[model samples]
Target: MRFFISVFIILTSIAPAWSDETRLDYSGRTVIYHSDVKLRGSQKRDVRYSHKANFFGAVAINTTKKTNDSNGAAWGYHNLKTAQDNAMRSCRFKADRPEDCVLYLSVVPKGFDFKPKTRTLSNDAVEAYNFLVGWSRLNFDSYRSFAVNGIHTWAYSASAPTREAAEKEALEVCEETFARSQKKKDPAWAKAVYLKEHLQCRIFVTFSPV
Candidate 1:
């Protein structure tokens, strides 16, 4: 009985957390978006169990409006661009405004890498980095830290004089912003599941005076 209980705990801890929907930013970064409409069981299974190589897939949805045929998923394709195009085509067939159809999720091979220029950062993080570069130029003597939660959120601190203080401030700022954004997106489940499951802000870069 104890062994069974332990196994249950382990399984529960490793269970996948699936949101109602997901969104892809302009840079192809995926963001968890909450919605009342849930994916079908088969679609969810495709997303959860997709691991084959040379297989690319994508999910497209109409952001402007929701309809029975306004969202689609395509998988098991040999090419990424093909998968994306097919997904969009499927989604736009009955969409009121086909132009509103956007790729919300993309699935590549098990080892495929998106290789984003900003790496794990969102567009917001890139903007923060740019701002940090300018701020550091003016505050050259002060210690600075840059932190990101690795989930479309980031923050920086240039006012602190010590590395530890700068890191702490940056983490606090980043976590706060992350929490606020998650809560605004899905108040009911963001705090209980998403934040607790994925919130980890770490200092990625630090600056020291010469």
Candidate 2:
């Protein structure tokens, strides 16, 4: 009888453990997932636009009159405008230059099938690279976004032909650029020279081409 009781207790304990691994909670405003591809199971259901009133994502930074500071990328809000405002506010509030807060990125939680027309890319490669990586685009078919933001430096690529391939290439390029900066050994040479926190790949798809 003692052995049976012990066995039963072990099974019950492990059962909850197994369930915990697969358990996904999609509560208000938190990002459960971000992808162009559809998710399986209960995660497949869409977040109604009306429901989007409670969720928003954004990045913002302080200005130096001539340039923008690093350390933006605040996320998870309800209103886009409010998100942008709060992000900029956060930057300015913590910044040496308090008056130069600016919005760098913002997006609401969109559905899986959500796709928007692609805008014209920049003619200049450098500027285009910055624009693509820093800003979110309208959903277009086969689109991808990847970025690496480190201390005082960042890089990104988007709307590539392939998903994982583009992401890998973007990260590689970003890492390569970061590595070069490390080799140069600028003023902040002693600081860590890699994307320790902000390395990510995001995908969005749209049906219409514009």
Q: Write the per-residue lDDT of candidate 1 for residues 1-210, one digit (tens) a residue.
A: 000000000000011223535444444434333233355534444344332322355666666655434465555443445455555666565467666565655655433455643433333355567777888889888888888653345678866778888888888887776566544343432332233433587888988865
Clashes of each: 0, 7
Q: Residues 1-210, candidate 2: write the lDDT tens digits.
A: 000000000000000011111112253333322212222332211222213422344444334432223323333322333334444545554457755444433344433112453321111222434455344445445445434332222334455565555565555655555455445333332222112342232222211223
Which is the leading candidate under TM-score?
1
Candidate 1 residues lying further than 4 Å off, grouped into runs, are 1-118, 187-197
- Cα lDDT of model 1 overall? 0.52
Off by over 4 Å in 2: 1-130, 133-139, 186-210
Per-prediction TM-score to the true structure, in the order listed: 0.46, 0.27
RMSD of each: 15.5, 21.8
